[model samples]
Target: MKNDERPLIACPQCDLLMREIPLPSKGAACCCRCGATLYRNLPDSLNRSLAFSISSAILFIIVNSFPLLGINLQGNANAVTLLQAVQSLWDQGMHLVSSLTFITAIFVPALEMGLMLYLLVPIRIGLVPPGVSPIMRLLQIIKPWGMVEVFMLGILVSLVKLVQDFRIIPGVALWSFVGLTVMLAAVASSFNPRDIWAHLDKDNDGKID
Candidate 1:
């Protein structure tokens, strides 16, 4: 590519437009003005991220389906699923807390995992799916709202207190929640969104825009 014909890349941090160039394997492009990492060129980023995303989705289903914690108070035994706990909060009239918890704990993470899969799978196979730009925007918008770690901390704290009065039986879903958190972390580290944009420039015939 000629100097002027090379693609333009505006720095995400300082908005300084620079000419794009080929990166070495596992290299990153940095902003000239602010030194922010513009993007990375990681080998097998798509495959690694896809694997973690798939694991996260499975763990997500398991977390919601089974009992998160089994409670036995004074001889009465009860099981509480994730949704059940959220419902209990709602029944207790903590409506705002319940809604926020639901969004952060359940809704946003699910959306993140689903969007990752939708973007990664097609790009892995060398096909660009529809709605790439909007999907990428949505991922960025929801990334910070996924408060799984915070929610997990709250669960652990509550369990510590509950163990004094109730027999806290660790359930499969509890383990799965921990696993989901780990898997999501793995997905985030492995996945690079710029890969999708790189693919977006290519047509089916492998033409670059």
Candidate 2:
């Protein structure tokens, strides 16, 4: 293998080996053998991630605002939102878990979304925003942390446990979470950072002529 050769990465899902092909600019490559996709192109993957992040953020607010489920135990009833669960953990002396939940579910996704919109919208107009490269790098770092589905899994598990103790009733927040998850998947599908940049570069060159 020469130093100039790109190394092949294996698919974690299927154990298929694949090489990275050079896209016109920087973009994701696909598995030659199994057609599985590899690598996300563009710092703007942050932007595509933002599409879901924004919706997830709004859903996060709603998930916190209202109770996720209600329970009836011997005619006594109680309801709790996702945030209430975190607060309960803190009240019960589980500070570390609460902090982790808050940061992963709330802070990281919000930061990723806000930074992406700040960068991409300006680039769409053909002006490189100040600190563009640094911001792009930041977007790449934050992209993986926007795990709304993981949070949803936690919610589902909580609901299952609550049902054993009381009559668990789902609320609007639950539905919102479902929608948020779908939207996040959609956002991921719509964004191909390499594709967007290739078009952007084409447009930029057109203007120079």
Candidate 3:
């Protein structure tokens, strides 16, 4: 009932409520009921998250700039970049599919990585940037919208089917897209919002506000 009391944390998987306990540096706390990891106190989490964000941003640029796949059919060569694929769908009147593909494959992932860098880079230096809370909330909302891995699976299926009819050549952008997906996932796992909250609370002298 006191503001100074340790906060209560509910296990996300099981909804079991328990008081939060202090964790050692580079330690993890888990839910007792479901044995799911509740939070981690990873050493240098901010720096690691910043690194991942930067890596993902570079990979994202590569994914959009270069061709993803090349095909040769009857001596005719064609290549498709990520943007070209979306544009082709739109040109064929599949506007909805084109928009969805662009959002999930390009927009959401880029936004997530950008927000991560914006938040973590300042936090790493013991300074909280303006609109930190709102930006963090936006990041959470966009997190689930990033479906790069799912898009990669669809690409793999298309590649398999296309290979049967034409010469399929995977491009540099395709590999970069794979790397971007992995980097994004790593950044998500490494960056715990609770850690950010803790840092903010400390900077504000025991309260986020």
Q: After superposition, how far is residue 174 of candidate 2 from its true place, in Å?
A: 1.1
Q: Quote the RMSD, in angstroms, for model 2.
A: 7.4
Candidate ranking (TM-score, best to worst): 1, 3, 2
For residues 1-209, what per-residue lDDT tens digits would candidate 3 score against the true structure?
Answer: 55458798899999999888888998889998999999888887777888988998998899889877564546677777767766766776768766876777777777777788888887888877888878978977876655556665565465446344323347787788778878877887788888788778878875443
Off by over 4 Å in 2: 1-54, 69-78, 124-127, 155-169, 199-209
The candidate that achieves the highest TM-score relative to the unseen native structure: 1
Clashing pairs in 3: none
Residue 39 of model 1 has an lDDT of 84
Writing each residue's lDDT as its tens digit, candidate 1 over 113-196 gives 888888888877777777777888888887675555666556546644644432334778878888888887788777787766
Report clash pairs, candidate 1.
none
For model 2, state the Cα shift of residue 109 in Å: 2.7
Error of 3 at 129 (Å): 2.0
Please provide, for model 2 over 1-209, each residue's C-alpha lDDT reduced to its tens digit, 9 standing for 90 to 100. Answer: 55358766687567887665656545656766676777655655645655565676687677668777564446667787666656765776768766766676556545755676675666666665666557757766766754655665564565456435333346788787677667755665555554544555665663421
lDDT of every model, 2 decimals: 0.75, 0.61, 0.75
Residue 185: error of model 2 in Å? 2.2
Superposition TM-score, candidate 3 onto the true structure = 0.79
Better of 1 and 2 by lDDT: 1
Is 2 or 3 the stronger prediction by TM-score? 3
